[model samples]
Target: MRVLILGGTREARDLAAALVDEPGVTVTTSLAGRVRDPALPAGETVIGGFGGVAGLRAFLRARGIEAVVDATHPFAATMSAHAVAACAPPGHGDDPAGALAGDPAGPGSVPLLQLTRPGWTPGPGDDWHRARDLPAAADRARALCPPGRGVFVTTGRRQLAPFATDRDRHYLIRAVDPPTDVLPPRHTVVLDRGPYTVDGETRLLRAHDVRVLVTKDSGGALTVAKLDAARTLGLPVVMVDRPAATGPVPPTWPDVAGVLAALRGLAAGGQAAPPA
Candidate 1:
């Protein structure tokens, strides 16, 4: 059995690790190459984009990929749409009236599954402010804080432009790679990546005297420490909402274990059943 895993997140890594010992199964992990130094999975790997839907279809047909598992970030709606379009039958047409008119997938297409981690829910003593997008989150963060207050921003490097307009608030920005573009004059960039610890997060927050935290709702255990630290300090969080999936949505699993079980069943001659 051949599997192509669209990977970037921790769940994708876990799935790749889990499949290492499976008999007669070959796994190839594909990364988008957005991160400067992405952690490699334990299998054959390919880096960078496949052009678009047409390019992806050509590659899949050429490579004889039997199944596809889209384990990308929830915010990666464009890539998800392209995957669906690429997997559709040769003559499949787009849906003009649907949300994703540019891309569409027909029924009985290539087997595709989406592996997503559950979103975080606000618990007791947590002060959460939700925003529809990055701009909204930045505005909300500014509104929630007094002038010149420190804010911790962890919404990745690409989305920092909106927050850069707020010159009054000081920002402690954290990302895997350093930002190249100019930011707010009062901001400090912390070049790093996670699995962050609660102690480290708490110390960082306290040391910066962060009055607010601005982040995307990228729900996973790896970055949840920041949320925990914020809660402990009674700080307000401005969370940017995840973009809705475009085009035909594939069956989704919330964890790597469920995806592994489904893949194993498929390898054993069973149908590619949806994760329960």
Candidate 2:
């Protein structure tokens, strides 16, 4: 059985690792190549985008990929959309006239699964201002922090452009990669990755004199320390909500173990048990 895992997260890596030793199964993981140097996962790996929906359908048909598991970030809506389209039944896919046409009639019977972590929920002592998108989050951040007050931004490099509109407020932006576009005049960029500790995050908040925390609700242990620190410091958080899923909604699992069990069932030519 051949499987293509659209992976980047730790859960994706874990799933890939679990599948590596399984007999009669071949695994290939694909990365979006957003980060400069991402940690390699087990089995074969392909970096960069698969173009668009048309390109993806072509690749899936050519590669004989039997199953597709989308383990991309929650914010990667575009890629998720393309993946769903690429795995849909024959003429029902996004590209009806493309390379998928060469396949047997009613092709793309592959099982499509999405492995997404749950988003964080606000708890006691958390001053959460939820925004539907990044732009709204920036506006909330601006409102929460007056001029001269700093805002700690952990919303990634690409989304930083919206916050740049507030030139007067200071921003302490942290990202894995450096921003390509020009930042606001009062912004300081910290090129860093996370698995951050509460103590480290506390010190960072203190050093920046941040009054507000701006971040996406990208749920995981690695970046949750910042939220804990914000709660500790009594700072308001402008949390940007994840985008709605596009195309067909596939079965989703919140953790790697669930995904592994499902994949194993699929590889054995059995229907995957519904998520618990």
Candidate 3:
């Protein structure tokens, strides 16, 4: 059986590692290649885009992929939709004269499984402002605080482009790695990941002279330590909500144990066999 795993997160790596050495399983993990220093997966790894649904379908057909597991970040809604569209049956409007969105039909369409981390919920005494999008988040950030105040941004590099597009405020940007593109004139980059301690984030905020923070709704204890740190410092945060996603939600496990169980079930039911 051959599986294509869409990954960039810890969950993605865990799933890929779990299936890498399984009997009769050939797992290929795909990364978006956005991170400057991305963590490598244990199995076959491919970096970059598959050109959306059409590209994904063709690749699946050619590679004889049996199943697709979308373990991308929760914010990667576009890629997640492509996986579903690639696997979805042709609509009534599909014409013989024209090709569909994804690849041509093969032995059968691939099955899709989703592995998403949940979003965080607000707690008492937390000063949180919600925004509809990145631009809105920026607007709220500016309106919520005064200039020259220290600010910590954890919204990832892609979204940061918009915030820095027309902003004149100074910021302390924290990400897993340095940004690929130019930042705002007054922005400073902090390369790190969290589970950051309260004192660690507090010191970071103080060191950068930040009075506010901005982040996405990527939920999980591993990355949420910043929230506690912010609250402890009495800093207000702007949290960008997650976009809607597609596919059947996979079971959540502390680690890869649950994913292994799901893989075992797929094998036992003979669903792991590649389509002819």
Instruction: Return the TM-score for each candidate structure.
Output: 0.92, 0.93, 0.83
Of candidates 3 and 2, the better by lDDT: 2
> Residue 256 of model 3: what lDDT?
54
Tens digit per residue, CA lDDT, model 3, 82-168: 877676544511221111212324434565666676689889879999987888888888887687766678987665776666455
Candidate 1 lDDT, tens digit per residue, 28-128? 99999989899999999999999998888788888887678889988888888887777766665253222112112443246677799999989999999
> If both were scored by lDDT, which would come out higher, candidate 1 or candidate 2?
2
lDDT of 1: 0.82
- The candidate that achieves the highest lDDT relative to the unseen native structure: 2
RMSD of 1: 3.5
Q: Candidate 2 on 1-276: residue-level lDDT in tens?
A: 888999998888988898888898889999999999998899999999999977887788888988788999889898988887777776677542221212223546567888999999999999999999987888888888989989998888885788777778889989889987667789889999879999999999999899999888889898999999999999999988999864457778899888788877777767666687
Q: How close is candidate 2 to the true structure, as a TM-score?
A: 0.93
Winner by TM-score: 2
Question: Where is model 1 more than 4 Å wrong at Cα?
Answer: 93-108
Clashes of each: 0, 0, 4
Give residue 74's error in model 3 in angstroms.
Answer: 0.6
